[model samples]
Target: MTPRYSLSQIVLHWAVAVLVPIQYWTGGSIERTHHAVHMGLSPDPWDVIQHQIHNYAGIAIGALMVARLTLRIFDRGVLRISARGPVDRLAQAMHFAFYAAVIAQAAMGFVASYFWFGIGSFHVLGSRVILGLLALHIAAAAWHTFVWRDETVDRMIIPRRTSS
Candidate 1:
């Protein structure tokens, strides 16, 4: 069988990885630095710009995730877990939770934007959820790589061929 993630999947995976950090950082920064109640000091215009970029990036990430999920469902290149071992089961559960969190965070971000900010939210509660899930996802990946010494994370990053 195939040796690695499809080019599209790999690209999407990395793209989301890069974008999510920016989304989280800017989101929190904007909320902290630009609160109307702040009596300390106003945020610079760049902070405002970063907030805008963060908002847009949220939408882009959400769209890309939806596309990734669609492709995973339709494409034959996506691999399945090889066994039902404990680690494998944990990986499967984490993967499912990651997808669900992504969807939920994206939806919430959109709604927060519309309700809280207006015209740009795009249902972004999912974005906040994504931030939390991302931390868990990364920790799980590290565990799989460093502690479990499994090929699961490696497979997603660089697939191994299966004997046919």
Candidate 2:
């Protein structure tokens, strides 16, 4: 059995990890920094700038998601989590839901931007749902690390040894 994720997969995983928080920060920052924009009031220059940043970040994430999905399809080295019991099946389902939510959220944001010129309640709802999913993911990691005494998370991390 493969013990580790491919370097590309690891890199992409970390990339998304970094990008997601930035996405949320920028998404919310834009709103808080200038709520008037959403109220149809005169737009502030800074608001436009921040909104642009959020838009670009979302686009970049979307592009990265596509690349990640492509790599997932082609990379045969991906480590499979063997389904040992109910927990394993639940983990698999959670993984699928996470990926689907991410793709759908990105699509929703893009569509909202294209048609409404800004994000709305639907995009915010998606963000909240994704946040909940992320919490579950982290909890699962903790469970593997503490209760299961597994090296699952370690497999996704970069090796400490330089001589790999």
Candidate 3:
């Protein structure tokens, strides 16, 4: 049997998974408002609410990412997955890409808040690229479960029995 991810690993994974989509939605809401105002259209009054939510969620995600990084570094039980095989290499690459994209997006949002100097938005581009990678990641996981007959995704999922 494959060793399962630690409890902290599972929690952090799900936490970020939930927060990222919410981050994207809130960022889109703000971007839309920005565009509408730029185009001389009246902005929706509720946009202010969305912007506030985005701001708070961004800060929270940033903090959680920091914690996630720390935990990842210290974690010794992360799935080894057949040492240096092609799929393992691809998974490693995607993991690194995710970390970079997520950190860049969060940092850009933070800096943009204080330094709005007519700079173009990277949120849309960043989100699209990251989302594409995420889709690939999901497809790979499905392949492992269905085609490869490996319990890869199961490592990340919480087990029903603690002492199994």
Name the regions of candidate 2 deviating beyond 4 angstroms.
29-41, 117-119, 159-164
- Model 3, 15-100: lDDT tens digits are 88888888777776777777788999987878867877877777777777777677667655554445478867778778878877
lDDT of 1 by residue, 1-164 (tens): 33566667777888888888887678765675557337677777777788788768878888888878887788877665565799768767777777777766666667666566542344345555566777888898898789988665776676445458
Better of 2 and 3 by TM-score: 2
Error of 2 at 71 (Å): 2.3
Considering every candidate listed, which one attains the maximal lDDT? 2
Residue 45's lDDT within candidate 3 is 76
lDDT value, residue 6 of candidate 1: 68
- Each model's number of backbone clashes? 22, 0, 0
Rank the models by TM-score, top first. Answer: 2, 3, 1
| Residue 11 of model 3, lDDT score | 81
- Evaluate model 2: give its lDDT: 0.78
State how far residue 151 of model 2 sits from its true place (Å).
0.6
Residue pairs of candidate 3 with colliding backbone atoms: none
Model 3 Cα displacement at 136 (Å)?
0.8
The TM-score of predicted model 2 comes to 0.82
